[model samples]
Target: MKLFFRLAKYLTPYNNYVIGAAISMLIFSLCNIAMIPLIARLSEAIAQKSIFQLNLVVAMAVGIYFLRGAATYGQGYLISFASQRMLFDLRTQLFEHLNKLSFDFFQKWRTGDLISRSTNDIDNIQNGISSTVIQLLPNMLTLLGAICYLFYLNWKLSLLTLMIIPLLSLIINKFGKEMHKVSSDAQKKTSDISSILQEKVAGVQVVKSFAMEKHEIKKFKEESEKSFWLSLKQVQINVTQTPLLAFIQVLGMVAIIWYGGYQVVTGKLNPADLIAFFAGIALIADPVSRLGDTNAIVQRSLASAERIFEIIDLEPTVQDAVNAHDIEIKGEVRFNSVSFKYQEELPLVLEKVDLKANPGEIVALVGRSGAGKTTLVNLIPRFYDATEGEILIDNIPIRDSKLHSLRSQMGIVSQETILFSGTIKENIAYGKIGSSDEEIKQAAIAANAHNFIIELEDGYETVVGERGASLSGGQKQRVAIARALLRNPRILILDEATSALDTESERLVQEAMDKLMQGRTTFVIAHRLSTVQHADKIIVLDRGKIVEQGKHDELLSKSGIYKMLYEMQFKEPA
Candidate 1:
């Protein structure tokens, strides 16, 4: 009930349309109620053979029905228009809220589960508000008018009809709870299936390589069967309850006909009045059954609303401070006793780290797999804030600067390049929006990518497949470098950038890297010891602590961790 009221707030903006719908519904209800009693009068007029009176009754019936049709159309149109506008507003809010969420939120929730909430869950809300309520409102109004008319004709008979109300309410309450539970379970099953489909489709190469096609199909079928059974249960409740409520109403109708007939035969009432009373009872039955179905619709929609609000209610852990502002950067980055862990319960990934990179210096990080090489550089960008202590850029704490302003001064290129599904030119230009054609070409040339790009059939206009599948990995890395160069940041981070490429590709990418590193504060995480040999300063980390720091040769001569790593990589096998 509380959830339903909260959803009603969306309808306030379209109150004028609601007003129009209400007015039309009122007239439609009055016409329906008036037509029932008029039927009794028409029967008498025909029995008397009075042609003039009979014609008058017949004409009024036609006119009333014509008005009813127009009113029904108007109410339906207005209500539908308002409901659709509400849906648009709600969907936009949900999507915008998703964008404001932090990186960790995406890591925790499955992609398919989020997509299902945004699409399928919202559709359920739409059905409840737009389709069910539109019909439900008119039925409820007509039912009320029919009950009033039944009482005016004979209070005893009306009171007898009212006896079924408590039983009907009990039935709706019992089954509505069951329906809500099943609906929530069914929606979750759908989300699970969607997750499986997305994972299998996106990782199709892995599945095919492992020959798990049969395994995947069997899993999918089992999930589908679960959803099917849940849906059948929901349908069973709906189908069973509608007739059960209708049968209860039929019991009331039976009692009314028997008692009213006895009154007429005993000279206690007119035939026409008894006949009109029965018509009113009949009128109320249909709407009562329709309203029972509406109860199930409401329950299903409320279940969906709960899931959607869970996302909307979430507050992002990472957000800009109230006093944060943009700052000018000269690429001097410092880490002062910075320590970090992804979560509070986990051990530190980086412990008591202290480092500095002056303007226009190349600092290369080299270490074993579990060492905090990448985590140390990630502090500069504030991807995850330091668990203890602070990091500074250009003599000011990074926490005092706006997130976008700080990140805009830096660029990154990773071993696995992420290229969107778009033309080659568009993908490169994404680094700097509104970049010109000539500027994009210049960046590509600097990364040694311009020559190969021009050799393609469509040149810069070639559409890269999903994650740039159409291009070889070496080509993708080059494009990534071109994108970084376009940003023209004062600081850059390269994480195992050329470690995955062949010898020829590595040479070309290395040349591009050398060109890009000039006059910038660069942090390089290198797996191949040869790549960092010329770095202005080399920092060797072991177990999340800096073990050595100096020029490449200076560190190598000391017989420390750096020397051991160098020998492990470049030494000839015995």
Candidate 2:
């Protein structure tokens, strides 16, 4: 019930449509009740054998039914309008909230589960509001009006009909709890199926390389079977409920008919009134049965709502501070006693790190894998805040600066280049939106990409497939460099940016990178020792601690970790 109220607030903006729907529903219910009394009039007219009276009853019936049809149409149209508008607004709000969430929040959730919540779960809530809530209002009104008319016709018979209410309520309440439990499980199984599909589709190449197509097919079938069984269970529950409810209502109807007939034969009630009472009972039964179905729908909707709100209620781990403000950077970055761990209980990935990079200087980080080199550079961009100590940019603590302001002044090019599905020009301009065509061409030329781009069939208009699958690894890397150059950032970080390229591609990319590094504070993480031999400062790390820092010659004279790594890489073939 609480969740329902929370979801209802989204409908407030469309209250006018809801109100219009309700008004139409009320009129529709009244028309149904008005027919009951007319049923009695028709019975009297037939017994009297008068043509004028019969004609009058028939005319009134036609008019009432015509009005009922109009009301039904109005309610259906207005309710649909309100529900669709609400769906659009709610889905947009969810997407915007997702964008505000921190990186770690994404780490904790699977892509398919989040996608299910955003799409299927939201659809459930919309159906609950439109079909269940909208129909519930008219059904309740019709049931109530019909019962009142039954009492007016014969109070004794009305009390007998009301006897089944308590039993019916108990049955619905019991079944509703079971429905909710099953529905929650069913939704989870559906999410699992979605996860399997998403994972397999994205890794199709990996599956094919390992000759695991049959294995993947078997895995997908297992999840599909689980979902199928759960769906079947839900069907079983629904079928049982409708029949059980109908049987109970039938028992009540039998008793009412027997007692009403006895009264008519005893001269205690008129035949026409008894006939009208029966009509009222029939009208009430329809709403009662429909309300039972609505209860089941409400339970299923609540299950879906719970999943959606689970995400909506979370607070992002990273957000702007109260006094954080934007600042233009000059790229003098410093880390003082900085330490970081992904989580509180986990061992630290970086520990007591201290380093400084002056403007326009190149600093290189070298070490074995997991030596905290990448983690150290990651702190400079505030991807994850340090678990201890502070970092400063240009003498101002980075924590004091707005995230957008801090990150916008830095550019990154990683080994695995990621490009969205779009044209070549659009992907290049993504680094700086709304950039002019001339600026794009200049950046591409500087990165050695303009020549190949022009040779393509569509030149700048050539479409890059998903993740730039249409381009070679070196080509993608050059495009990435071009994008970074276009930004002209004050700080640059390159993580193995040229490590994957062939010799010729490496020479071209390294040349472009040299042009990009001009007058910007640069941090390069490279495993190839020869590339960083001339760096202004080479920092060697081992097990989350900096082991050495100096120019290439100075580090060699020390005969330390850097010297050993260089000898191993440049060692003669055995």
Candidate 3:
């Protein structure tokens, strides 16, 4: 009964179905308990009477069993269906909320950790939904019904057994908190270890080049040891709870036997009634043991729910305004008096610098690494919000526009071209899902990628390896270009798009870009000055401040940083 599982609100919408399922489960519990009295009667009859009466009792028991089985099935199916549907809806809800979260959330989290929460953590919650809530409720009802009947059979014996119930409850409740703490600690360490392993594996080449195999292994050993100790402690606690509870159960059973024996000796209780009391004790013991075990499961589930719910309950930083209306954009982007720092206390990465790219102008941003070139262009797409100042797309402040509508008009190609594991056609079509095959091919051709694509055995059907490792650096860039081309956006941002390739590849990318930039408003970030020499406007940044802004020739004549950079690059030997 967490806020999230308050499916009372959700079920209210499906109240009729929920009510029917609950009623069916209650009826099943009732029927199951009803069999206990009939069982005691049959046992007593057999104890007193001969085989002549046994046939009728046996037939009645068989019929009752079959009817109970049918009711149980209905109860199980309805509860399982509702629980799974609730989990499905919860997953969708979490993912939807995640889609709204700001870039800072992703920046601070490890991909592997988030993935584990959505998969493994959510799965734990699902188990709680399926078995814990749905099944526990029914079992408790059955146990309660059985206790009532036992009380009716012999009130003194019922009181004796019931006296031990409070002790069992206290024991489990105490142990449950301990299990939750240990389990949560263990699970967090496990997620951290997984993320570390993933990072090491993904960057194996870097690890190898740095010869940090032993170092990495040592780090893993430390984390693995921590995880081991935590997990072992968690399991130890869980394993002891049950046996200790069972030992206490044996004491309860001994008390029942001793008290009942004295009563029978005094003729206070009949032999059949004493036996039936124990039988009822056996019935109570099963549910009691199961409920105790379920407490452990609930502890683990609550721990998992904390992780899963973290993402689900996260507040998105960059959500669209509630009263804002979607605007039809013409891609006239402007950054006015913008200043941004990753963390508020950190130094500003971009200062109060005004910049703009009028529709169809190819603006170039050139700077050394960490000069905040990427950070500047990233604002146009609202990937990260500016700490101070307005980013306007077609004169509308980005905070006031619909997120999807604003993003749809923009396309980005980064320095490292990322390709999906799919056919070449599929990769290009990723730029615009549902684009026709002909459209995809044309986009590839526009990016100077069509010839090589067709040269492959299956043409557009040729499968690209993971991360497009099968393709050459140049081919990957062209494919990325084709992807952006297919987007057919009003604004195109290329961050060192051709930096990964050879001269031949660069030439091909440049030619494709010429076509790509014909009418599109494009922002280019390049360290190689020769690449941006022909840009309509070149903005040069030193530190977080813009030092120069003009066409190439104008800046070159000024004999400043741009002139110095151009001469250094253009004068180099080929």
The model with the greatest lDDT is 1
> Which pairs in model 2 have colliding backbones?
none
Native-vs-model 1 lDDT? Answer: 0.90
Over 83-193, each residue of candidate 3 has an lDDT whose tens digit, in order, gives 667667767777887788888898999977876777777687777665564677778888898899999998988898888889999999999889889878877987898
lDDT of 1 by residue, 1-574 (tens): 7898888888899999989999999999999999777978887887788898889999999999999999999898998898889888888889999987877789899999999999999999998895455878888889899989888888988899899999998998998999999999999999999999889998999999999999999999999999999999999999999999988888878888899999999999889888888788778877888766888888888899989999999987776889999997899989899888878898998888889999999999999998999888777887778899899998999989998898898999999899999999999998899999999999999999999999999999999999999998889999999999999999999999999999999999999999999999999999998998998889999989898999987997898999998898889989
Over 479-544, each residue of candidate 2 has an lDDT whose tens digit, in order, gives 999999999999999898888889999988888889999999999999988888878899999989
Model 1 stretches with alpha carbons more than 4 Å out? none
- The lowest-lDDT stretch of 10 consecutive residues in candidate 3 is 3-12
Residue 228 C-alpha lDDT in model 3? 92
The parts of candidate 3 lying over 4 Å away from their true place are 1-21, 572-574
The TM-score obtained by model 3 is 0.95
CA lDDT, every model vs. true structure? 0.90, 0.89, 0.83
Ranking by lDDT: 1, 2, 3
Candidate 3 backbone collisions, by pair: none
